[model samples]
Target chain A: MVEELIIAGFGGQGVMVMGQILSYAGMHEGKNVSWIPSYGPEMRGGTANCSVVVSDEPIASPIVTEPTTAIVMNRPSLDRFEPMVQPGGLLIYNSSLIDRAPERTDIRVIAVPANELGEEVGSDKVANMVVLGAYIKARGTVSFETVGQCLAEVLPARRHDLIPLNLEALKRGAELVK
Target chain B: MAGRKLFKGNEAVAEAAIRAGCRFFFGYPITPQNEIPEYMSRRLPEVGGTFVQAESEVAAINMVYGAAGAGARVMTSSSSPGISLKQEGISYLAGAQLPCLIVNMVRGGPGLGGIAPAQSDYFQATKGGGHGDYRLIVYAPASVQEMVDLTLGAYDVAERYRIPVMILGDGVLGQMMEPVSFPEGSEPENAPQRPEPEWATRGARGGRAPRIVSSIYLKPEELYKHNLRLQEQFKRAEAAETRYEEVRTDDAEVLLVAYGTTSRVCRSAVEKLRTAGVRAGLFRPITVSPFPYKALGERARQVKAVLTVEMSLGQMVDDVRIAVAGAAPVDFLGTTGGVVPKAADIVERAAALARHGAADQATREGIS
Candidate 1:
């Protein structure tokens, strides 16, 4: 099955890095995956999003119009991408930042307090990872162990010590969904 | 299978260039492709290679010409407007028969367009962005993996024919990340050394004659002869290197022709069309210059109609028309100014074309 997702938030929210980590985990599972960022001026404080496609077969367009899943970490991202989610798919939002819930009734909506959970896990910088953890746990998209391995690869050697905090954030968020 | 690694397209291209033994890179910064030079700057030095952040695109191309003349594997990259500035140098490189790589991560344009993905440069890339009937063997990659693979392949093709080659991508492909793998031992340290050309401008030493690397053919006859030789090389490339992919073309009632990022959208549209019980296929040109016209023309005979899709306002469509050659009517759908065409819209339009006949050329313009 193909899981096409759009992960969007403010530029510093690690939206692009979240997409990369998930795509890297997909690769570990022998899945064909692609991560396409909405780069350019959006790299500033503007809303940044990236389309992540993980599939058993070769992925077609890296540009996702109606994604099977939408992860909105901020209000603007929800306002923009909420309508683009496919019916009977999934919508995961960070309730810590977004006050309103997704209005789509056909799709399953999961509200995780990613920022709060991230702070509880020791830092708010990994709020994106918290949301990612919930999505993977709620959807079983990839295993937590695989994500751990991917984090090792994604982080630089100097920053490897932060893996424990990131793992804690991931586990904390995953626990909420569980 | 080799271990999979995540790579942004621009970074992947840099890695591939290094693996292909490219030792010199000269380029100016531009949006949608700045990562290419940035990656080169960080990595080339580690490999004992040179990366020159030239003053301008014009200087960068001349630097490429210089490095290529010295028999070093070299490359330069730019966006659409910057590419135009290098046209004169490109023509000279072709005339001098210097093998080099030029990458254009195309952005929307006729002028200084937005920093978004576009295939608008199709005409400029395939029909000689430079003057004097020179063609850069253009390879349009549809994915990040292809971005790396075709980059390695482009060097071989350029060196084989001693002509400049291009790997045409857009902002989408340049900025995207994907799992890419290279063959074992494909890294620069493990790859075979690129053999130096005998005609290189090595300085006179020991009893050897000095070579002149020049494009100035003063006499009309000499210039004509040089052009003919280039044409012969082009003819050989057309015969031997035309690359394309036919997806579900057998028993297809309608065919969608596209390349680069547009082709990826077309593939999604084809899947949607099939689900709707519309028999559709996708024809993607991997090599835009040695266009798979003959192959597509033969396939056109079976399909009821052809719908050419592009990010540009119908540039490659003209070639599709020439290739179809009245065997099947050709239609077009596109957007300009950095708006990417949607797959759902492509499916709807392609299905309509399959039901009705191909629209006339004038009417086709209306569809865009």
Candidate 2:
């Protein structure tokens, strides 16, 4: 199976880090994965996005022209990526930021209060981790245990102190989807 | 620890170059490739190498020239416009027969174009952008692992031929992250060394004659002989270094020709075409300068049509036509200004070509 996902959010929302964590976890699970960020000027302060692919087969293209899932973190991201999800695919949006509901009826939609979940777990900065937890619950592309083990690999040693908080956020997200 | 780890393309290339014995890195900051210099700055010091951020692209390339002249494994990286500024220096290095690694992580445009990725530098890179009858062995790697492999291999090639080699990448390849394993350096640090070749510019040793390295020859005959020698070296590289990959082309009715990141998309397109009951394959040129023309033409002669897809306004198509040589009708589908084409569209075109057989541009457009 192949999972082509696009994760988008404002620059400080950890969009790129989320993708990297997933990619690292996917590799730990013995899968081929690739992650490419939107490295244009938008990366400074504006919206940033990344394309991630995890597959049982070798990943052909890292550019996601047709994504199976679009995980949006803000209103702009939701508005931009809501319609791009393929039919019977998934659209995971953060309801804490986006006001309007999704317009696409062809794909599955999940409105997650990622910010609330992150705050409930420990720190609101882990909102991206909250959404990632939900993503893992919905797709099951990589196991949460593997994600927990590989979080240290994706993050630096100094941030290792925050692994427990991030793990709680991932657990809360997975529980929210369940 | 190096068995497998996630790394950004730029950072991975930097570490790989370090492991490959690259002791000196000189470059100016440019968007999409800034991480290269930034990473070098931090890591080079750890390995006892030198990283210099030159004042300008010109100065950076000249610094590369100086380091290479001293028999050091040297490198310089830049984007499109920055690369253009370094053109004169690149030509000078080629003329002087210096060995160095030059990286062009191409961004869009003719001028200061967009910071988004594009392969528009195809002609500039393979066709000799700087000037003179000179050619640099240009490599186009599709993945970050290949980026590591080729970056390490490029230095050896540059030294072996006593010529410059270029790693032609773009924003996507430079900014992306993937799991990669380096050939060496699992211990996190190694002593970077600068090997002095016999022709190095070090002061005449042991009463030997002083070596002078210059690209200038006042006499026309001297320059002509020098040019002939360079041409002979290029021909030898063409025969020895041409590399490509053929994916399911034995019975392919239509062939998709592409390189670098674009080739990965075409690989997916090939699978889509086969699923749609069309016989399609891909020809990926790993070495763009010493392009595998003969191998491509052999495959092209068997196919009904050839579709050349690129991230430019059909630059590589010229070389594609030359290689096909009318064996099959060659068509091009290009998206310029950093717009990457979709695999679905590539599949549609290849399926149409496979169905209609030799669907020229007009005929393919007329199908609908």
Please give fnat for model 2. Answer: 0.80
| Residue A3 in candidate 1, Cα distance off native in Å | 0.7
True contacts recovered per prediction: 0.83, 0.80
Per-residue lDDT of candidate 2, residues B1-368 (tens digit): 23788788889888888777787999999999989999999998887789999889999999999989988889999999999999999999999999999999998998989998899999999998988989999999999999998887787788888779999999999998888987655333654444578788978869998998889989999999999999888899898989999999999989999998899899999998888889899999999998899999999988889999999999999999999998888989888898887899998888888766744533656864
- Residue range B177-282, candidate 1, lDDT tens digits: 9888887788777867656588887676777877889999999999999899999999999999999998999989899999998999999999999999999999
Residue-level lDDT of model 2, residues A45-66, one tens digit each, is 5999999999999998888977
Q: Kindly list the per-residue Cα lDDT of model 1 for residues A39-108, writing each as its tens digit.
A: 7686557889999999989998888999999999999999999999999999999999998978989999
Q: Which stretch of 10 consecutive residues in model 2 chain A shows the poorest summed lDDT?
A: A37-46
Give the interface RMSD values of the models in order: 1.3, 1.9
Worst 10 residues of 1 chain A by lDDT: A37-46
Which TM-score value belongs to model 1?
A: 0.96
Computed on alpha carbons, the lDDT of every model, listed in order, comes to: 0.90, 0.89
DockQ score of each predicted structure, in the order shown: 0.76, 0.71
lDDT top scorer: 1
lDDT of 2 at A107: 93
